[model samples]
Every structure is written in C-alpha cells, then in structure tokens.
Target: MSLRIAAAPPLIVPVEDLLRETGAAADEADIMRRILAEYRTTLLGDRHPLAEFRYRHMARKVVGVGSVGTRAWVILLTGRDDDDPLLQAKEAQESVLERFLEPSAHASHGERLVRGQRLMQASSDIFLGWQSIVWVDGRRRDFYLRQLQDGKGGLDPDVMTARGAALYARACGETLARAHSRSGDRVEIAGYLGSSSAFDDAITSFAEAYAEQNQRDFDALTAALDSGRLPRVPRTVEE
Candidate 1:
C-alpha cells in the first residue's frame, strides 16, 4: 500500500534522492517543499484536487534534443488511498529566437510558454501552471508544470513507409497550421500559402536543405569525436 515501496514505478524516486541526483544541495529538500507548497497554494489554489494531495516522490526527466541541457522533473502526489497523480515541471529559458527578434512580452519564460501552449493546443491540461524558484545553485529558474501524461500519441518515422511518412508529414503540417491559425491572422496566412503545389514544393526544398545542414553538423560532431576533440559519453539504459 505504500507508494515508496521497492515495487514502485521505475521513474519514481524518493524526493530526497531525486534532489540529490539532480545536483541539488543538501538543503534543497526543504526549499523544494516550500516551492511546491507555494505552487499549490498560489497557482493550484485550495479548490484544486492537487491541493489536497501530498508530494511523495520525484523523477528527473530528460528533455528531448530540442531542449537539451534544460532540467525537468516529475513529481508524484498521492491523495486518497492509492490515488496518485504525476506532475511534470520543465525549465523554460528565454526563447531561442530572442537573439534575432524582439524580446518576449511576458517576463516569466514559464508563463510565456504556458500561455503559448494554451493558445495553440485544442485542450490543455487543467493543472497547467507556471512558477519561479530560486534553485540551490542560487539561480532563479522558471518552470511550467502540467499533468505528466496527457493522452498524446505519435507515429514513429523510423517504422513508417514512404507513403505513410508523407501522410504523417501532411497531417503534422495541417495540425501546425490549425494551431497557428488559432493565434494568428488566418486569412493572411492562407493567402500567403495559396492553393497550389508551389508552397508544398518550397517547403520540401527547405526541408531537404535543412536535412543537408543537419548532416553536416552531425559529421562535424563525428569528426570531433574521432579526433579526440570531444568526449563521448556512453549511452545508459535503465530498467
């Protein structure tokens, strides 16, 4: 009946252990509790179901390649007997495009991301929120939180046939268009794209160019590794 038992989910680790593994200082445990408490109190509020639940465990999650080096953590909370919920907090840094464009209107990066997600997604997680925490390392980091698993699904490109991949790509394009239209001037965008294969061809050409650039970057990385200019970390698998 204890969620902290040895048979607990593989991703779930003791709160203290999660902090240590994520490189937090010894006093991080207490600071983490205060941060979560404030998150629940100010963001979730007393009316939220999660407000009644207690923080039980945490898991450090690896953000994908696009978000490389950003810290993310999933916290487990338990309410009534065996009733558990997982919430993920992902670090949100300034927009990557900031260097080339105007600064974001939203001061808090986490709030900016949360607002964008709410605008783009058809239906976002009810518990989605943002918070700022002064980490043990003395840096104030922004993070956005949401329910860990939402029923999102994706097809694997590696296992897809050419035709299937084309269909999948079109579907992804449509989805992105819909999301963009919701937050942008749809009429202007539609007029710009037009009803022709020219737009498609242009997109394909750009994709091909991008793939070639990506390959060059990979080759440089490989050369660095081969010449002992870069340290290669062994891939680890956990069970």
Candidate 2:
C-alpha cells in the first residue's frame, strides 16, 4: 500500500545555535559526572530498593524536542543476574507545573512526570521516582527514574491506513470514556452520548481543524528556516 506521512517538525535551534546557547565552554564530561553523582545521592538514596543493582555504564545521547537544549543522561544498570537490565533516564531540571493547568513540584519535576505518567499509562515500569538536588552552582534540578526497556511499544502512524485510523480513533474514544468513567457516572455519559453519531462527527471535525493548525505551524517553521531566522540542527540518529 502507498503510504503518505507528514514531514517531521523542524528544530528550533540549529546544531551551531545549540552549542552556542549552552555555552559550549561548560565541560559536558564534568557536568555528566556531577549529574550522575547527584542522581545517586539525591534521587536514589541509600534507602532505595534498587540500590543493590550495580551501575554498568552511562551512554550520552540527546532526546526530546521541546527540551532539547537541556541536559539529559541515560544510565545503564545490571543486576547480579546478567540477563536483567535496569535503565534510568535523567532529565535536567525545568519547571514541571508551569506548562500545564495543574502544576506541582512538592517532590520534584521528575517525580511529577513519573506520577502523571503512571496515572495515564495502563502499565508502568518499576523503579519510577523523582530525585531532587541543589547543584554546586546553587541551581536546583530534578530527575525522574525509570527502567529504559520495559516492553514498551507504539503504533506507527505512517503505517496506518484510513481504516486503521478510524478504528484507532474509536478505540481512543472508548479508552477515554473508560478512563473518565472511573471518576464520573458512566450511565450519565452513555445517556448523553445516547448511541448518537453526533459526538463522533464533532470529534472528527475538531481533529481535522487541529491538524490544519499543526500544518500551519509546520509551514511557519519552514518559512523561518528559509528566511534564515531559524537554525537547522543535524537530527541525532540515536535517542
């Protein structure tokens, strides 16, 4: 089957701009060392259940689009049983609540991500928690911990046909209904929807409108690049 997928979004910062923005003067190796030390000391204290697992190595890689310039580290850990794998992704500190309607940082941003993600996802990895610390520079940052590979998978939208999209949309609606039903009256919702096609039509219209807006934003970014306003970054092959 012929497949048409939308182009990926452009990077806000070009590779050169990213290097300049981060003050390339900062020793990345030294920063990693401090982050790792803080990760173990502040986030995973002596009381942590998984402290027994020995850290094998840390691999440096860039991940995420919105927070690309921030520091992120992926740490690998191994148990006495060679087959067991433990992964911890440490993201640099940024305000967790500022971006959303509900904000919370009582524990830390990392902990909040773990908590919210756990609440939304059907299944979650073990060893998810938040760690916080005051850096040597007096700046505070938070890190969230989780096993890197825990049998996670996602469908490729590019591979989805019209039929697949329709079925997926229905499944998403059912899932959302089921999630909301846990907190509200399902009988009332069923009565409101009343086996009507109106809700589906409304949702479809909204989806199309949002998709158009997304396209507009993408075009604006492209225009910025062409006008020499936005810098392009070499996409990292590794996540």
Candidate 3:
C-alpha cells in the first residue's frame, strides 16, 4: 500500500528576509549553491535530473520540539518549466544517545544521521544526502538534505477509535521490530522476549513511569517560568 502525505501548516518566510533575520551575509546564497552543487555531483551524480535544477529560494523552517533550537532551512530548486522541488537541509549535531554510549564512527554527524535513517526505513527519500559547509560566521556545520515530506504520513490519535488506536500501535510495533531485525540479532531478541507477557508488562510499567516523569518535568518548568526563575520568550509564530 502507498503512504499518504502528512498535512502541515505553512511555514514560509521570504528568502532574503529569512537570511537577513538569521544574520547571513550577502553572498550566503552563492555559498549554499556551491555546497548543493558538490552534493549533486558526489551523492546524486551529475546525470540525475535534479542535478540540472537551479537554486531558487529558501526559508527558515520552524521544526518540531525535538529539533527545537537547531538550524533548519528549506531550499527551493527548479528545473524546466514549473518543476520545483523543496528540500530540507537541517543541521545535525552529535546525537544525544552518544552521551550514554560510544561516539559514532562516521566523521560527519549529517552522514551519520542519513546512514541511520536509510538503514532503518523500508524506503527513504531519493534526495537523502549529507554535506558540510562553513557558514559566513566561519563555523563549519553538518547538514543532511531530504525531499520535504515525500510520501510521509501521520495518524491523529485524538480522532482515532479504540480499535484504530490498537491497530496503529500494532503497526508501529511491527515497523520497529522490522527495523531492529535489520540491524540487530533477531534470534537473540526473540529468545529474550519469548512468548510471555513479562517483557510487555515491564515496558508498560516503564512507559507509565516515563509519562509521570515527563509531566513532573513540565510542571517544574512551568513553575520556574511563572516564578521568573527562567526567562520566558513569547512565540513569534502566528496561529
């Protein structure tokens, strides 16, 4: 079955205005194009249809809470006629998991993210690639590029029935299992899980505790903001 594209609110800012707001220099666009050109040649190949596409515009993309405070931008490229493609180039930093485990072997964090995504997913975006560039501020940053929301879908939990929610959960579990099986020892994992509810119950308990902890963290942050112990910046995004 084919997947549906997820619906999202518009997040466009004028190209020049975005650059100005972000403190990019006048020649930043040219620098970005050079980076894209290198990516096109190395990863996508010069024969790819997108290789001939010319850079058009770009904007600052407001990402979700998980990627909050990270630099993200959407680039527009056009080929012949009205053919346009939107690609997101998001900054990739050292993964949070690295704090607990060994550091990644991949030199570039962007490449690390792209490789992990390609390995875990059944299919990935055709434009999936990574590049590193030194910004106008002289800071080198790593970024992975992907076609924006290509064949992506999302389910709304608020509108789901009990049966639908269960089905969704099952689907999610299956997907996670498939991904893990691809990268891990399936036999070992199966032996550990073994036809028992013990593992499931343990996971349920962990999830419940995690949710309670999340709520407590949120309450603590709210209290701190209200008490002026933490500075609260108003959101500039319009509803």
Candidate 4:
C-alpha cells in the first residue's frame, strides 16, 4: 500500500548575528543585494547564456555551518524552456578554509569555493565563479555565485534502514577509493594503507568519531534555539 504523508516544512535557522561576529558588518543584506546586481552585469555579462532568462525574484537565506551567518541570496530565474533553470546563488564571504590550511589563498571567495568543490567532487555544476564588491565602508569583500540546485540528489541516513546504510556505506567506500585512484599514485597510498582491510577499519573509526561530534554539535544548536539566541525574522519562502 502506498502511504500518503505530508512533508514537514523546513526548519528555518537564523545566523545573521553569527555572521556579524565572524567579521561581516551590519547592513549585510543591502550589501549582498548590491553585490549580486554587479555580478549579473560584470561576471555574467550582457549577452550571457542566462541573460535571456527572466528573474522572478530573489530572497536572503542562511546556509552552511562553515560560512553560516554570512549573507546569501538565492535568485530564481525562469526561462521559456521548461528544462532550463535560471536559478543562481550568491554568497558573501570572510576568510576561506584554504587560508587556514594553506599559505596561499585565492584572492576571491568564489574562487576558493569553486576550486575546493572541484578538488573534492566527482563532478561540479557549470556556473561557478567569484566576484568582489566594495561596500559603502570602502572595504572590498569576495562573494561566490553558482546555480542553486541542478540535478541534485542524495539519500538521508535518518530514514535509511540498517541494510540500506550498510549498502550505502559500501558504495561510498568504493566511490572514495575510485576517486583516490583517479588522483594518481594509488599504489603508494595502498601500500601505506597496508591492505584494504586496515584502511576500511581506519575509515570506519573516523566516521564513527565524526558522527559523535556531529551529534554533539546538533545538541548545542538545539540548546541555542531553545534559549532564543539565534536571530528571528520574518522570511519569505520560495519553491
């Protein structure tokens, strides 16, 4: 029997105060709007592929823990063709993770996200780029732009059965090993790992530890929400 169930609405999390603490000044929303307008003109160009698409509207939203609280906007672009999506995402930036890990960081935030995503992902979306904007304070900050959600699919572990999880874990392991092999010198890595069994055990240990940490972080967030520490504002939703 097919069960008809209504999906619960997404829980909105506010991180604007967090952004301000991280280095973004007040009035970040206005700054983001101005930045996106310039991006469409400069980076995208007048006669670009998506130029013909009509922009229905844009809205501000919070996303990602690493870059949480920073300004982000998801633009809805509609095209005459049903298959084409005119959606675009614009994110404000601070220091990138690469800057902490490596001495040489990209000049722009968009470049960092694009380069890192390329390095980690098997494949990436086509429209990804960086842009810089000088705010009213006369300080220039970097922002990255990309398609919101193009051909995105993923399974949630919360709903997965044990059998499903095991199968998914095996598939993930195979995928990771394949990705590592594609990057070259797999024989050396394999030798260092000293048989697949040891490597698998190490990965499993790390995954379990990380999962615990994730639970702790989730609990902290829940506490914060209950205490009303996060910013609460009326938000407009779009589908």
Give lDDT per model, in order.
Answer: 0.79, 0.63, 0.81, 0.64
Q: Evaluated with lDDT, which candidate comes out highest?
A: 3
Q: Name the Cα RMSD for model 1.
A: 6.0
Candidate 2: list runs displaced more than 4 Å. 1-52, 81-83, 92-105, 150-152, 156-159, 179-198, 216-239
Q: How many Å off is the CA of 132 in candidate 3?
A: 0.6
Residue lDDT tens for model 2, 1-239: 33322354432323334445556655444654555555565332457646667655555445668767665546655667777665556664546547775556456778667766666656556566656655434567777766666474567889999999878878877777766675468799889977879987898899899999999999999999999898775443422
* TM-score between model 1 and native: 0.73
Candidate 1 runs further than 4 Å off? 1-30, 40-46, 59-62, 150-152, 212-239
Pairs of residues at least 3 apart in sequence or in different chains that clash in candidate 1 = none
lDDT ranking from best candidate downward? 3, 1, 4, 2
lDDT of 4 at 188: 91
**Global CA lDDT computed for model 4:** 0.64
Candidate 3 lDDT by residue in tens digits, 1-239: 33322354355565677568668767756866888887775354456766668887787777879898888889888887655668899999998899999999998999998888888888877788898888656789999998886576889988999999889989988999999987788999999999989999998899889989999999999999999999876434333
Task: Assess every candidate by TM-score.
Answer: 0.73, 0.59, 0.76, 0.58
lDDT-better candidate, 1 vs 3: 3
Clashes of each: 0, 0, 0, 0
Candidate 4 ranges beyond 4 A from true positions:
1-48, 54-57, 64-66, 81-86, 92-101, 156-159, 178-188, 212-239
Give every collision pair in model 4.
Answer: none
Q: How accurate is candidate 1 locally (lDDT)?
A: 0.79
Give one digit per residue, the lDDT tens place, for model 1 in 1-239: 22332433354345567557678666644666777876664353457776677766676776668878888987777888655668889999998799999999987899899889888989877788888988656789999988887577899878999999989888999899999998899999989989989998998999999999999999999999999999866544444
